[model samples]
Target: MTQFEALFDGRSFAAILFDMDGTLLSSIEAAERVWTRWAAQFGIDARTFLHGIHGQRAVDSVRQLNIPGVDPVAEAHAITLAEIEDVEGVHPIPGAREFVSTLPEGRWAIVTSAPRALAVRRLAAAGLKPPSVFITAEDIPRGKPDPACYQLAARQLGWTADDCVVFEDAAAGIRAGEAAGAPVVVITATHQRPMDTRHPTYVDYNALGATIRPDGRLQIRSQSTRKI
Candidate 1:
């Protein structure tokens, strides 16, 4: 079998965890528009700053800037509000809806840095249904790169981090998954160019599918010849 097809060969996972934004859907345009506006308000270069913010909690990303006189919490809240109000261009990644539909109910969760409200709005805008075990920024004390959110998501699904597979698209989320002891699948849907990663990577869910074995184990199958 090809490397892509061999990804989950001879293995089974108790659950699957996914990062919302760039993993299952694309909100790039809407997010960039709002962030650029916010950056302008703070006199920061939006283009350069956007690189460090994806996959991180807004407050954490803002706090890291350490901009004088800026309240990260308040600014993050404002950003979230703007994002929620602007769903223009929000849409599911290729094959996202079909792939998600193949999974068993209650065996998957969406772990996102977005606040619950924003997550819901984005999912709705993308025409995807929110999973039963949705874990959002408000549900965890820490965000991506911290592993708290992934761990919490695994726990909520009655599984350990190691028993679940994480689908991520950003550096922070990849680190979070590794730190949480979950194997990660890198989704490159939102990437501008190829990313150097050790994990199995895919451009989108177009070449993937999942099925429940008779033994009650979830098996992921990939048909693409894409490098992994």
Candidate 2:
């Protein structure tokens, strides 16, 4: 088990919120596949395109592609649809299903940048049927790094931001959670390196393990191993 797995031994956190893409579902490969195909149609380098917008919204990514005369919104929609249709090998992160099952049903929800359609597809692929309070890209006027998504989710859960613990795999999502005043837990799926530990409010789940206690406080246990 990772350090994160060990941290859940005997601590307490009220509610847990998760980001969908890299946090819970492995949609990076599927995303890259669809994005590369779209970039090729515009004669752009796929790797360059992917690196340039690794954590951006679809519309933001499309606009950054800088393809002359392209309608970013329409292109984003098309590519997103294509990605949903072509999705393969998409699955939940390790221990994700068990973790969710252990938590209180209404105490957890997904707050993701993916549109509802693609989110649904990816969640189904991961064999996860989330609670009804899912907050998608469609639900927010602004995306990650804006804190709107996290704020909306907290409101829907009827919990204050401080009572919520956010599980995120992206730097942008982490920032968003912090901005929303939630304690942020970094799930080390995509981001492998250790982040700055100066902030006490921010903890790496990769370093401390997590588990749901009988009382519903997420137990975070610190282990000998540094990496989660």
Candidate 3:
């Protein structure tokens, strides 16, 4: 469904919470290179490994893989270090910078499964500044699909679930935002939209527009139910 515009009727949020990798940064190629190499070393299928790890903490993913003789924490650390150095191909998703920059200062944040150092590196490499409030894997006790990361971000921003909206691209992240009780959800197809998808979706951040309401909350306008 294509359209020139659409209406996104929810905007009472005081802040917006965003996922990192797929939502904002276009780092799949970089991640693929690293994970593929790692998977090769472990005799694991890169496709399956990467799919299983999406939107998860590196340590958590490592544990889930159940790779024998691998120290999950140490492995995650090594991966993070490698990812930090693998800055090639890191860039912003289309319309990401323009849309994110339009957000009011201190009214938005990034909640990512990437460790703080790696997240910082990617944002820098992508030329996008991390917002004032960033909740990384290191700060999270649980990653996406747990809601802890999203809830933590809202709380740190002095907002609650309904007071913030979430923009996510991955299934785990969508679950996290929903679990966090975010009132408005914007699902981006930065990675790929699922066939059974059940959320307002966008091709990129350009599908959204924002204007401050009289009450000071942003009126997040978006195209209606169009597959983007």
Candidate 4:
């Protein structure tokens, strides 16, 4: 753990990239509710089906499933609509709000698999203000596990991927971050079980803090206090 802390102890970064759903907030309950219903409607086992789909764009997940007689685009649209209507249990991950609040505007961005409207709605539901640079499903032709979205996000922030750090909570997002050539930090906020990964992991942002250096680089720090 000491060695892991050493990675970010005094390092500075050009920008920070975040994945919205699981990283910034815990929307699993709400999302799974809608997906479970969608699975039932399509006669697919929700448990097995959902196991492999996190951090992927809905349309991409639908197309990959290739359900007979189902139009991937239309089905994805329906699912998105259902998700937008269900924010019942949506809430920010512990310490997430505080961590985000400390970030300077324009030094951070959100890259999500959700559509623009859905992303906005969920962020609002979770009591998180949307960042100025938000990359959503409609903004990218490809989704996670593909590095394009992360790369695009870094470029949007006027930095290269090598200069940014990505905070992710899903396997696909982690892969995307690594592939994009950025350091990845795993957030276990929404994990049901321990995940197998080499990246430094944090349960929440309670022990995390950050500040902008005089040179404008973002410095990530570990703290002993929690902010409610």
- In angstroms, how far off is 192's CA in candidate 3? 4.4
Supply the TM-score for candidate 4: 0.95
Best by lDDT: 1
Worst 10 residues of 2 by lDDT: 198-207
Local accuracy by lDDT, each model: 0.91, 0.74, 0.80, 0.89
- Residue 228 accuracy (lDDT) in model 4: 16
Candidate 3, residues 1-228: lDDT per residue as tens digits? 322222244436688899898888878888888888887888888888677676778888889888889999999898888888898988898888998888888889999999999999999998899999999998877788999998898898888866787888777888888888884355555555353456666677766777778888866766445554
Global CA lDDT computed for model 1: 0.91
Question: Which residue ranges in model 4 land beyond 4 Å of their true spot?
Answer: 1-3, 224-228
* lDDT string, candidate 1, 97-124, tens digits: 9998989888999999999999999999
lDDT, residue 144, model 2 = 85
lDDT of 4 at 109: 96
**Higher-ranked by lDDT: 3 or 4:** 4
Flag clash pairs in model 3.
6-222, 6-223, 6-224
- Answer with 2 or 4, whichever has the higher lDDT: 4
Candidate order by lDDT, highest to lowest? 1, 4, 3, 2
- Per residue, candidate 2 scores C-alpha lDDT tens digits across 68-184 of 999999998998899889779887877677667766677788998888998898899899996778998888887888898988887888877677878787777888888999876
Using Cα atoms with residue i matched to residue i, what is each candidate's TM-score against the true structure? 0.96, 0.84, 0.91, 0.95
